[model samples]
Target: MCVSCAWGKPAKPHPLEFCENGAKATSWEVTNRRADRAFFAAHTLTELETWPDHDLEEQGRLTHPMRWDAETDKYVPVNWQDAFEEIGRELRAMPPEKVDFYTSGRASLETAYMYQLFARIFGSNHLPDSSNMCHESTSVALPESIGASIGTAILSDFQNCDCIFYLAQNVGTSSPRMLHDLQDAVSRGVKIVTFNPLHEPGLQHFVNPQMPGQMLTGKDTPISSEYYQVKNGGDIAALFGVCKALIEADDALKASGTSKVAGTDAIPDDPSDAGTVAFAAAMAAADKKHVLDHDFIRQHTAGFEEFAAAARKYDWAELERVSGLTRAQMQQAASTYANSNAVLMVYGMGLTQHVMGVQNVHMVVNLALLRGNIGKPGANICAVRGHSNVQGQRTVGITEKPGLVPLDKLATLYQFQPPEWIGHTTVETCKAILQGEARAFVSLGGNFLRAIPETVAMENAWRNLRLTVQIATKLNRSHVIHGEIAYVLPCLGRIEIDEQATGPQAVSVESSVAHFHGSRGRAKPASPELLSEPAIIAGMARATLTKGVVPWDRWVDDYSTIRDAIEQTYPETFKDFNKRMFHPGGIPRPLPARERKWVTRNGKANFITPDRLFPEFSLGAQSDDVLHLATLRSNDQFNTTIYGFSDRYRGVEGTRRVVFVNTADIARLGFSNGEAVDLVTAIDPETERRVSGFTIMAYDLPEGCCCAYYPEANPLFPLDHHDTKAKTPSYKLLPVRLVRSGVAPAH
Candidate 1:
């Protein structure tokens, strides 16, 4: 069972706790493996470096502190004191800004807070983190539209919504727990509409492995009521098309004298509507049953007029061509959503990991605002995060670019002058390293080398660094890509308990829905030699900083003191952090939107509109014989960490070198199923930007779109190609030409 599943409740056991995906996560974490000094001794650094990612991880878990010996190019065992002292000396010598503190979602909140505090105390704001790569776009865009950066809806809202609009995300494979919610919603007659390029099986049918009957019979549970395979990067066009259809539908209703606009409440406190007649008058502006949240639009937001004008100016026909969805499908989704009492819209990396990722998020927010779906139960926007504690990491200050509140509060709480300037984000950090501006890199968790785009370049940058420290659970690619002085410190995994000078420590985590909960580990420590993240950080801070520079030892010995410090900093949110976290389910932070209290400067929810319908990046000229490849994971994969190679739903066998291309595209390109081909990306003409020797497989995907596994094809992605506003790599839109290995051009 997953850690959050059946283990949480005693009486009412969750039926989907033991799903195949959860089993994979658990097995991978609690594997019977140990990669100690002996294992490292057996294999030379060069030999280990030559091994594939899976083979190295499968070798075993690390059991001792290891330091890279540059002479031998191997990791030699060292005492914890020597490793910490060496790292401390490096940090003490360099300017704080020269060193970047990076963290992964797997790190504990205590560790994350301490890491940020230590960096600030040491006089650097360089805290490039994993979030910058994935959901930084969401964090950047959502705050502008809504008062908060997080999703407006909670998980419980799923049970109350009448209709659910799911876009771009494959919930079954990415988050198996989400399927249970979808199935529950379907059973309650919640009309589910899915927009994706391929028909995901989880959106079709999901059989709970925990359900004895379903598991034995192999019967599947239904998920979506209707599914539409929109073209890649076509979400914006589809949204505009649906909104246009909605406008048309409203006009038709008005002509028939059956419009609901007549009875709805007034557009609260809209001065633009001042001296204007009624709610019907404002409704008449759009000729729709619901207009945008006028009060929310006017005060707390900007660019309403521009957004409304763009919505009014968009043409259905143009949207249809761009989206590749029929006018009927667009009309159906719009009408279904408009008529439903409460509708919830959900999106994931599919929409966010684009060059126009922020704009894409704004469009989704625009759709929700038009129907007044936000700030109400069962009707809001949901951004499904990839990492387990990603939301919590952001909450606890694992950020390179800190917000005004976080920086200001941190300065006051820690008694240090925090840097006013925005630090380097993930993309910026990579650029800094390449430019020789950043010298050292410290990662709390996550394989930075494998996770980031432009793999070869990032590795080269890592090699140039002065020192690289990785506090990890097991060996990954990042460990082998050593700097001049590299240290690999094994830390306790999420499933393992952290025992310190005080007692068992508890860490807090914020879920996707903005609910904060306590995550206490029950499993034993992987090894006695391993140190908790907090202790490791505390030791480093003590070694680097002079005495009384900060209270590092006090917080490290007792983690509750850290929570108390967090409470002091964010009193409103975490008034009684320690006491409240003691509750079975930690308290939900106060979101102004939850109570319809907008915290914007205008103190109202605002409608923000962009001058353009979609960003320029989304609109591109179609290249002949070139397919836009979107890299994705199979049911067996999790981010960059692959559990196995078998994708059961795709019906693929033991290999990741398979490409999912449409049959028509295959015919047009003159490629057959299982034909070996080179998918050359249209990125860097000088360099060979192609993933060679991939078996072409025909799948039920849309035309002008193809699919392949990531990190493998990540080489094809250019380093500079990213979202202009958010800097998230456009993994979804890689224009490339496919060719047979030895065959000449058809021309």
Candidate 2:
């Protein structure tokens, strides 16, 4: 319901009206791709490891529990009891600190609750999930700034918002349904301002495929009212420019007091005028409104004076240089923000996957707070998430820090001391595994190895592990890249029935828009051999834990009891879990921020002052020869899963191996428009990484910035290149050099 960018409640009537992007691709998954007991017996792990991502997943749904057979070099089928027994024995032999439990966004709230409970009771708080890779910045920043990790806007907020500031999200490939929201907003005359290195086509124009007349007549609806190509990793400076312009306009409005004569925001009429003069003349034509919410600042906020003073200190020239946008452009964008009664600040991974990811979110929240946007009808921060249930997983206790969780309640419930030590995140998990500190890896579905950076080194480290266990629905690269004692345990998919002792059971999933949805599988199970994710975790917990404090068998039989347990752990959020959330359109999980109740340390919304004008490695620090490489998802991809080889929005048809660069950069670097080249990163000279033979395509991004599809380009960046506070990798602004295909490497 969440990740594919579909509405929390999907549209209907016409097939094209289904706003979920991955629906059609997901429907193609039938028995044809099923990897039965025989399929596992047929292919060796080595043979499967050689296959590409698209080809590998096409092998179909995994049918049974299979253990790595070193003697035969193939996966051999094993019974459930024996498999759990073996895994439990190995885990029991090692310290719990040496085991890492990672989860994907696909798991349900019930499953995630059970998974983390098991990890905590086992004397380790080492729980990390898909949130670490994507919105960890949001998870960390929002709470510190506004007292809630989740954003304040609901799905309906899009309908009410007067203006939308859409930043760095390529909705064409990532979430097509979000375009429907923008289109609906546009139909209502809402102003949409977009900022990104490459201005995607969907943000420019869209002819609805559902409306035959529009498609046949070639009548298109424009989405973005104004588009700005903000440089990669330059969002903070760009935001500063807009903030500077807005504060200056407010200062002028306060000084003038409705008398508009030579004010800071006003301009005189001039005949035969240039574009800047025309814009100024248009602004001078109307009476200006005070931009900042003075009353809201006085009553509900702290640190405004300090934040405003810092904004006033920034020079226009420096903002122009760092943000790659002129003062005029910044003022125009700021004018749009100030004029609108309500503005929704929207952002995506382009803002998060950076060294200043947390700061980037803080700035977005600060901008929203300046105009009193939080807790309003159509004004708030919207951190668009990537995977389906990723946010929900975090809501149910999948995290590296256990301090955020109610430790005393859990300890009393289980009658055991909970592990309070900070856990290893995705980046630390890899380092621990490489250093031989972590011996076991348990994942709740995800192509972890392929999706991470430093693919070669990670794969080698993965193979050296003592044990690796994957609870999944389908075959992927992780299944093939087996550890010494790897076990692939097949589980029920979200689309299949998960029957238990309490009749057909439904698992609750939290959507990105704060809705708690009950996802029930109508279809039959993929195979009789498949077990539910909660059942699998329960089985492992029963075999491993000697105290047997939890009723693992009963929890597996009745998932509703699991919900009750979750409510007990997180009473404020998950209270009345069974009664409130299991219906047609699920009830919204309460957002304290939406009510203007800041749960921060000082009990007021805090306006943070960023220490530096330019975040992370600034534009001037790197040479012109170096380019910022951003990894992205194609049209046919969902997260790390590739459905096909097509990205129709950008005109790619048969290949995924391509790099997008500025048209001038190709000439500046002595390369043709479509020439093949090797991407090399010499950031870490000792561990210089390279990916060879990628076709170069001239695109509309700024110079010194390049783009490439993910997974294929994952190896180009090192493991240590990440945001320190959030631990999110710098996938968006990796500095690299494009050399000719046959040239020698940098290091």
Q: Write the per-residue lDDT of candidate 1 for residues 1-747, one digit (tens) a residue.
A: 133221121123374355666677777877778988778777777778788887878766678999988777788899998888999999999988888888877666667778888887777778888778777888888877777777777776888899999998888788777787888888898999899999889889888766779989998878888888988888888887776555444434444354544322222222232222232344455455443344444434455555555655666677777687887788777767766767898998888888778888888887777667787889888888877677777777767665644777776666677776678888888888888889899888888888787777778788899999999878889999888899999887767888877988888767677766676778877788988888889888888875334677788778899888888777887878888775643577788776766666666555555445444422225557767788888887777777778888888889998889999999997778889997776545555566788999999988989999877888778777778888988888777778887544332
Estimate the lDDT of model 1.
0.75
Cα deviation of 706, candidate 2, in Å: 0.4
- The lDDT per prediction is 0.75, 0.82
Per-candidate TM equals 0.91, 0.94
Best by lDDT: 2
In candidate 2, which residue pairs clash? 3-388, 33-60
lDDT of 2 by residue, 634-713 (tens): 87888888888988888888999999999898998888998999998857767658999899999888877899999899
lDDT of 1 at 454: 74
CA deviation > 4 Å runs, candidate 1: 1-16, 255-305, 601-604, 610-622, 684-686, 742-747
